[model samples]
Target: MSPNNDKETPILPWDHFSNWVHAICVVTFDLELGQAMEMIYPADRELTERERTNICYLAFPDSNSGLMGNVQFHFRIRQCPQSMNAHTRPAIHTYNSNCPTSIQIEDGYLYGYVYFRQVKDRTLRRGYFQKSVVLLSQLPLVSLFTAVLELVAPEYFETGEASLEAACHHLDQWPPPTPATTLNLPLLGTLIQVRIPSRQDKPGASSLTPPSPTHTMSGPPSVLIPTPHETEAFRVLAPVLPHLNLLWELVITAEPLVVMALSPTTAANTVQTLVSLIAPLRFSGDYRPFFTIHDSEFREYTTRTSAPPNVILGVTNPFFAKTLQHWPHIIRIGDNNTGSPSTQKHKLKKASALKTVEQKPGVYTKYRPHLQADKGLVKRLLKGVQTGRPVEVQSALLRRHLLELTQSFMIPLERYVASLMPLQKNISPYKAIPSLRPFNPDEFLGTLEQHGPHLTSGIRGDWEGLYRRFFRSINFSAWFNARYQEVSDKLAELHLQAVCDADLGGWVCSRSEVEVVDMVLRLRSKLPRAASLPPSHPARDKLTQHLHTLFMALPEDLRAVLHAS
Candidate 1:
């Protein structure tokens, strides 16, 4: 049953994806105010001081690629702005420039999906044309939103307000965030057919495969996460490829990891990809794709002696290299100056063996990768790049390889977890509830000798070493707790069932006379029936009949006292 609390779960009036897009604001860099929202289309109502401040600040990212390029980032509003009447917030309106320079969130959920761009231009006084197209919504659909922005933002930059108005209206026609359904969204002279993942779906549960033949769909799906399109996936994974094994361990163990990239787009996307790597087993940890110095907990996150445990932060600014130097695990990606006469996308310069004073651009880890890298997979990826294969095909290759690798380890864990369930008959209400037997690493590893990673994957090495270390991590603790609680709750439910189904009459009769009296009184305490009720409740009647049976079997003196009561 859904909770009755309105703040926790608002009853939204509008149901489509269009309705969730509450505002389409354009943020620009002003010499005076660091960032300001200049235009808000269909200015439905004036934004209060708090709304303007937060919207403008978050709309434009704190840092950039340093080079001219379009970048993307997401902003999370802890609460909605006060003026946003949740029930009426249907279409997104741009932000206004009414002298206010800050923004604040309200009491509900909201997010800002921004497409920030910077370019060297002679017309602008700052010697750069800096602006961001922001879509304010009640959800974060990064993969889909990023794709849409890639198409809309450049045109909006060229056509200005007119383009934004058309795009916003077109987006207004988009359906709600429904998973397992195909959608054809029309915008800017193109009809796009794709199945988008639901923001509500757990990671790894969102299927990328074509629907089974028995399941019909309108058409094939398009680029999705866990495996993004070749360019984005390559950009995200390439910088960390040499340390892929180490990175995987970090994510698997749910360690604190910070990704430093030149672009917030890359930083945030990489964070999202990291969480998705070990899909099916959700990463039960906190993560921020783009962490801003202006965020409320900026001090807590940056100035802290250690990065928050199991928290992943992606930051773009070089300043973080020094600010977050104390962080234990970091992946700093190489920046690609895309516009610098470089036609090739994925080229790399030699990585510094240590963190750079400015922006270190490689995996920063002393942790050894227990497993050997699959030279075959690396060869395939490099061969495709050398031969100039389609980015989608190459991205798919990496995606498939990673997916298989994840399954190789996860299957055994699933089997082990299932094996832990106690037989229903073993559950007893009269005694201590049974527990899932402790996980003995040695015993479990013994099973791995037969059905382990080597049988399922081409990549092979110290699998035992990997699992042993994993048992010590907080990731295992969380995984165990979640599964343990579930099994414990099931055991409780089974106990109740066993109590209800037991031969209460025979069991009670076998006990001493004193225990029978106590047991009857205890059973009666559970039946909260009013004496005023007309003599029958199914629950009360059963207990009454059992009492009568006990009375007939009881000593005459005890029966007389029970009958009198």
Candidate 2:
């Protein structure tokens, strides 16, 4: 929308730095430069010094690696305006969908999908190879983008830039990344079918769609999330499944939590999955799926005197066990290989001290969950697996229960908020505008006098205390603020339309001297357009001549109102 931007420039899906993706980067460890970004794909994206430095560092953030294989993880980086081409301005994915849900990006952030690898090689002087294939994008579909990289990065590892060119060529043939629609995109001679979820869609309300379906269904995109709970993210949660209710409480309440796992992939995926738990409700806390000791906020996050910030960190280094000990909650995880290949099993227990040696996984927390765990659900899952039920269905079962639990907790609040909308007759341009009713915790509780929030998951208890606690939480604040802004905008639009529709002469005749002056002041810029109209016209005469006469006729005492405003 800037005057300097080239509006006529056509935006293509594989433009190297298009809206779908910003760059396909290759970051490598140099002999002297430490972590370095060796290539910016398409070779046309000339990044600023700040952007280059940030991508090189943030894309491959870990400072210590104990393994010599590829470990895929996700991270977010600060967006640099100077590094962006004008065609990359925020806009719809395409003109065809007419879908209003575009990329939901904050002011200065970009999602990074990284496939970091370390391998043994004799060709290098260090006798080892370290590099990462990075996909930088503005979209928030972490699972979708990571899956795309999985199919593309393997070939790039072997053929280098030629693979990227081939990938980009194929990417150009694919459809735009539009939400609320199912896209059948072709990549490396394979068709990837995924349905992007809308912000309004609730989890568990629709069937879970796998990445590769047995047959393509024809129709509008199903109402669902991009990825199901039947992913590695859920498998990572297996270690702490028994403590899930507590995990939900901690996450929804915005408490600082850490995901500890032996594999960086597990740690990062778990963190991202936890962040996505409050689907339809945005997470407003800082999170680092892949945290490093040398990160910019290391000192601030680990200082002994400070209370732990409301954040989520996924760490592989054993050093965090001692460093983040003072943190409120910790969910330690282990490899998912405790039993047969058909089942996912892991060991975890409550511990006074974290396992510093990085062996088995365990939960270390003193705070109790508000609602008791739904033990029956766990039993049913185990029972189903015994009867040859698809174990993959277990994640969906747990996922649906959690979604319903969250929705139940929010239903009363949502109902109460709906009542805050002013009666249509109460809104008028001639009168002082009214805003949505103020949110009062005690008053809000009065509406629940007959009954408290009911959980569809069947977990029950006195959750009044939890409701009170939620009003003070960042999640509540964020959700309420969003509602408040939405209502405020509605009121503003109504007022503007009403004012525009009102008769100018009749409106002026009913106005006070001060109101007349205020209206004239606001209309000064528009007066020229009215003057250009035919003199016989109603709006032209009233808005130009009659309004000017009324404003000029105002007393000196009333004219002072203009100076004050």
Candidate 3:
């Protein structure tokens, strides 16, 4: 439709009609260094350079008028190596008549948009590259397949193919999509496989808490924490932090209680993850405070032998209630109103009046499975939640309930991905599975042309990709909120212990905060199109400045001194 492309008339009805339209919009790129673009689209066979140019010409007839809104792709291309030949250069070439143009070629992968519109002006110049020439010389198979596929399944192949063809043609845009983002956090569960001190020796080494020379050996607090009537009715288990040559972390008066207050799921996950990592430890005997509270006079009537500080235990409703009264700032563990004064009184009364009953006849039983993949178990868990007799139990029962809920939600996610690529069962079907290696620019374009329809539909969730994985969706706020709650609770507990000091009596300053630094670093490494981002872009400049400031803010002795302190 462009003045340049107007010379060519469609040989076939398919060519005359708008089979597919693609809009290539590049919002952010660092042309000089090259970058990778993050794109979400379907996959298919390739197209020729002429075909690609034709697609782009028709898709974006006017440089002034952009493509459709929905069809957007984000990716980066590697910077083209110096002394670049035509093969190494970008496939798409444009001579914009308006602005000063700079040529930056990445590994020839272009990041932009592809729009499939109904009608548009056909007045644009055919781009530099020709689909026929590229197909014949560079990508024969892809071009051939695309042609065949277009004939066989025009509806199935054109749209995604057109977009990819446009992307391939525009490879000269200066960044190749390859690298991805990584938000680094400590590998949580991966730690179990790591080298660690023996669990048994850890307790002994940790138990060697030197007696305070400056402080007096005070007896346990006189205030009697309400004793549970049915102590033997339920067994409780809690996770002890991994011993890294440090004293046993005290969660009670150790830190402020405000930190543990997070959503139920988050708090539960934090407790579970922590529990999974460390050996189980229990708390027995009277629920008594470690430090004695005096009321003006030193005389105490209800003193008792305090338990060793090393043991870790779950705070039951009663224990949770008593602890809150003593340590007013104790972080609430779960989303349930356990800490809310109004809610606490009710739960306390509920805890005091408890009973264990036999299972009802003809009732279906559901047990949580060890792995999330068990479909049978998921069905049973859902059934039980829907209809089951309630049992008054310990934290383990609560955990089991939550586990069942989590597994039920996750199983469907895995099954959905599996349906996408039945041939490739190893990877999740829902995600945009990457090829093992970056495809050649020409060949990659060809592949897109062949399979573009499916890819675009897939990304839109119009087809299989929608059913793929929850993780694939760009909507991450819900998931992030869930995760954030979990991390916050666990971190709150860790932080409390980190700030506790024997001399200062809970005013101990936090010595180490490398976790935050490491998190930021990981996020930096995962930045898309980092290499291609220009020095002028606000995002690029902010990242650079933040990193600089981060490094400068650290004192020479910071790492060493913090750990030691």
TM-score: which candidate is best? Answer: 2
Candidate 2 has an lDDT of 0.67
lDDT (10s digit) by residue, model 1, range 1-565: 1112233555343234344366778889998877888887546635666566777776665664464677777765544356555453212221111101111112254667788888898898899898998877654456666677777889999887888878877776776434445666666765555554443444334355543444334434333333221134554676555555566777887777888777776777788778766654556666777777776657777767554666898887767777777677777766663211122333232323344534435566556667887767767777777787776665566666666887787788767877888888788645556889887788889889787888888787888898888887776776778677768867765654455566777786578888777656655554443232346534446556665665666689987886587
State the lDDT of candidate 3 residue by residue for 1-565, as single tens digits: 0013232544432121111211222211223422222221222223343333332332221212232322211111111334122332121121111111111112222221222222232542322211211111111111122222222222222443454444333322322111111111111111001111122232212221222444223532121111110111111111111110011111211212111222212222232232221122211111111111111111221122331232222222222233323232222233333211121221111111222211111101121112223234334433443464232223334334333433333344223323332243323311222223221334422333344333322211121221222223222233334334444444433322222211221211232347434523532453443434455655555545544444444565764553363
Candidate 3 lDDT: 0.25
Per-residue lDDT value at 36 in model 1: 84
Query: Which candidate order results from sorting by lDDT in descending order?
Result: 2, 1, 3
Model 1 residue 366 CA deviation in Å? 1.3
Error of 3 at 351 (Å): 74
User: Each candidate's root-mean-square deviation in Å?
Assistant: 9.3, 6.0, 33.9
lDDT of 2 by residue, 1-565 (tens): 1122455777654542364666788999888998888887767756677667666765563535476677777876555677554443534324212322222455456677888778899999978888888887766677677777887888888888888888877766666565556777677766667765555455445433554343435432322334522244345555566667777887888888887777667777788778766654567777777776656567888998979898899887778888887787787775552312222333334545554534555677777678888888767766765686654576667677777787788888888887898987888755655788888788788877554476333677657777877777888897888788778867765654455566666777666776776666655544554554467755554445644565566777665765475
Report every candidate's CA lDDT: 0.63, 0.67, 0.25
TM-score of each: 0.68, 0.81, 0.16
Model 1, 200: alpha-carbon shift in Å? 15
Better of 2 and 3 by TM-score: 2
Stretch of 10 with least lDDT, candidate 2:
94-103
Instruction: Kindly give the stretch of ten consecutive residues in candidate 1 with the minimal lDDT sum.
Output: 95-104
Number of clashing pairs per prediction, in order = 13, 0, 62
